[model samples]
Target: MNLRPLRPTDLARLVELNDAAYPAVPITPPEEMTALLGQADFTFGVVDETDSLLGFLIGLRPGADYASENYRYFDSRGADFLYVDRIVIDATVRGAGLGRMLYDAVFALARDEARAEIDCEVNLDPPNPQSLAFHDRLGFRRVGEQETKNGTVTVALLAALL
Candidate 1:
């Protein structure tokens, strides 16, 4: 399998993968995704030789950030750090180790950028337990928790020193 930046042609496939992985949670809409892609700081997807997208990772330049609860989380790591907006893998490809592939690519990006840390939040809904476990398995430690619009509590944050 080959890993690459998300292309305009892959947007619809990404939408499908994200929606399938995050059924209860609404995935990012195409318009918002387009704006995000234009930022040039986001890592897009992991695809195979046939160009089938397996998963994706999206993040932003980190700084003083806010949780869903409006609580502030600060990182002194400076401009190099990235705050992951979301990560999703296609269900059909779940057991194939693509998630780790996507993550390692993001980690490599962080290192190449001279980043100090990688951060992200995981939703607390029971159905999303795999995310929490996945992050834990990746060496991220929990920092805190917060609640979202639907009263779904989200584990506030998790970070790994890169």
Candidate 2:
């Protein structure tokens, strides 16, 4: 698979992969995704030669217009951070290191921008142990946690220094 900037044409497939990730992330509609992508400071996807998106990461810099509780949660902690609004690896490609590769790209970009750290969250209420473990292996630590979606969902906020 190759990493590249995501295209508008990839939105449909992106949404499908995103929905499949479910409460691990969130089920965002294509329209909502388009809005988020527009606000994204960085975006990347892993794809095969056919250009089918196998995994992706959407990132926002400090002070983005996005209103996600998770994003705002990080802002309250501090600035000079790259907030990973969402990341989703296709079910078939979950264990292939595409997620880590995308995160490595984020770390590189953050260093280029002279950012302080990377911030993201994994489900707690929904219990995504694999995701938490993956982030842990990537040197992320649990910074905090919050309940969103009217408290139906809770997440463990994670951060890693560049």
Residues 1-162, candidate 1: write the lDDT tens digits.
778888999888877877776643457688866766666367768888888888887666754333423223524433346777778887788868887888888888889889877787776653567877888899887766666666755454678787
* Candidate with maximal lDDT: 2
The CA lDDT of each predicted structure is 0.71, 0.91
TM-score of 2: 0.97
Q: How does candidate 1 fare on TM-score?
A: 0.82
| lDDT (10s digit) by residue, model 2, range 26-88 | 789999999989989999999999888999999998887778999998888766899998889
lDDT score of residue 12 within candidate 1: 89
Candidate number achieving the greatest TM-score relative to the actual structure: 2
